[model samples]
Target: MKTASFPSLRVEPKLRQDTESVLYDNESLSQFIESAVRQQVELRKANTEFLARGLASRDNARQTGQYVEAVDVLEKLQNRLDQHKAKHTTK
Candidate 1:
């Protein structure tokens, strides 16, 4: 596999100790930190993509006049909940 180097990070003493303790049993600290950084970067990329898609969907809904106001949505949900509670309470 290809290899890359990361600059040294000055972490808190306790954080460094915790990382080292977890890494001591299996892999080197460098490998653990590299894997962690890579995972974080990928996670952020996925989150950005998800937010972009959601915004696009909202824009489409708005353009089609399909988007309901927050108050309207809340009222619908509240009505449903009230109906559900009424039914269950009487049973």
Candidate 2:
């Protein structure tokens, strides 16, 4: 595969030293930076999706004048947690 060069990133000496200090034996600085950038991109995408879902829920509630009671929501969440715990504990 042909790889093109990415823009050069410049950081302070202390930041560079700190980053290098935590790397594994087989890891390279370029690989670490690339991984960090990829993680950040994924995190931003997830945040965007979360915001969209929240906005859609708000619009739906406004249109229908319907919303779940907090107590009901909490009960459902607790039930899910309990079910998950039971499954994991038996494994």
Candidate 3:
């Protein structure tokens, strides 16, 4: 497959040096920047989906007049976490 290139980026010398300093052994600067961009894209996509789901849930609750209390939700989540930890704990 043909490959495309990102536009050249201009940054301060210190920032360039800092980024280079963090590069893994034998890893290229281009690879590092590409990985960072990919990670940010995924994070933004996840955040957008999370917000959409929450909004949909809110609208559905308003329409149905069926809502869960914050405390009750938290308590149930805590119980689940406790159970998971107990189950996974080494005896």
Candidate 4:
């Protein structure tokens, strides 16, 4: 596949130095920037999907006239969080 290139970016010297300071050994600035861009793309996509699902759930609840109580939802979430914490703490 033909590879495409991103436009050259210019930053303040201090910003460039800060980025370089955190790079893993032998990693290039281009590689680091590409990885960062890819991560942001993935995060944005996940957020979009999450919002879509939430909206769909809201619409479904409104249509069905069967909605969970906030207290019940919070209790379930808290229980799940507690279970997760307990599982990790035992490890």
For each candidate, what TM-score against the reference?
A: 0.65, 0.82, 0.88, 0.92
> 1 or 2: which has the higher TM-score?
2
| Per-residue lDDT of candidate 4, residues 9-82 (tens digit) | 99999999999999999999999999999999999999999999999999999999999999999999999999
The best candidate in terms of TM-score: 4
Higher lDDT: candidate 3 or 4?
Answer: 3
What TM value does model 3 have?
0.88
Ranking by TM-score: 4, 3, 2, 1
lDDT tens digits, residues 36-67, model 2?
99999999999999999999999999999999
**Which 10 consecutive residues of model 2 have the lowest summed lDDT?**
82-91
lDDT (CA) for every model shown? 0.90, 0.95, 0.99, 0.98
The regions of model 4 sitting more than 4 angstroms off are none
lDDT of 2: 0.95
lDDT, residue 64, model 3: 100
Flag the better candidate by lDDT, 1 or 3: 3
The superposed Cα distance between candidate 3 and the true structure at residue 50, in angstroms, equals: 0.6
The candidate, 2 or 3, that scores higher on TM-score is 3
How are the candidates ranked when ordered by lDDT, highest leading?
Answer: 3, 4, 2, 1
